[model samples]
Target: MHMDIEKLVESGSIVNELDYERAMVADRKLRLLAKTNTHFKHLRNKLRNLIVEYEKRVWSNEDAVDAELLAQSDRAQLIIEKERMFLEKRKKIIQARLKDFSLTQAELGLLLGHKSKTHMSELINGIKPFTLQDLVIISKIFKLDIDSLVPKYLSIEKIDRISAVIEEINNPKLSKIKPTLLSAS
Candidate 1:
């Protein structure tokens, strides 16, 4: 199994507890065939790194964190953590509903336009993101709000970006929607 290294490193990268378990399972499977399998080793290592990064972010002072003070890479990792936290909530809801509705992963996967159950698993587990359209489809079919499918949270970078753009636009009407823009704040 090949890991998307570039994706794993990007701000968009998704790594979660399930991804770690999958990596460990893959590592074990690969090791049984070849102890020194480079591909599995690399994939496992990257997943470990991401999990470590996420775990380190849970400081007691999290509320005091300011985006401006973080280095670019730290900011990116913060985004990863934020995304993972929000996705975990949606994942829990979806998984429970799947069983309640007597639905198989493959069936839901197909509905989400994912022909491969593994890919669907990735999306479900937060190892990969679900597209907005995919989430909307799930919401419609499952009688869930799109917000419930993805409760709102903004990464620090996005918050800063919106703040900057609003400042640049200099539109007084933008002030009316400021609360919506920084909902997480």
Candidate 2:
């Protein structure tokens, strides 16, 4: 990753293929984990229940061993929920920004340094995740503030500012307006 950063700094336009490949693998693993997390949750709940029942019978005087485990499980569940929500929110924001910019999948693919539009489509559809590097490049190409890409980090003021900028960009008449010279009376 350090070498990749150096390459990016030196070339300015080149992306390290290895870094992208690693990100793709990481993305797939995350997606799989998300899909299977419910199973883990179910197991945790079952284990907690069994521990509680055992404690009620043979270990009535014993300390609650499942308390720590249950707390950890709850924390894990919360983290998973937060991550899922973040991903969903990010996907919507990216889709909206893409529409606002009027960029096609192929065009976006080129901008993101992907040779195939399929890869771009996958990224867009949440099949392939967007890495931090991808987000930086996309933000630069789209002239978007990085905060606007993440729903949690975005504020109402920032959204208003982004909207104003988009309006200015889309309205040719606004750009064409010339400043009138005022004569002092």
| Winning model by lDDT | 1
Candidate 1 per-residue lDDT, tens place, 99-142, comes to 98899878999888889865676577555567879989999888
For model 2 the TM-score comes to 0.41
- 104, model 2: CA deviation in Å? 2.8
Cα TM-score per model: 0.57, 0.41
Q: Name the runs in model 2 displaced over 4 angstroms.
A: 1-65, 125-127, 150-185
Q: Give one digit per residue, the lDDT tens place, for model 2 in 41-73.
A: 343344334444443553355554467545544
lDDT of each: 0.60, 0.49
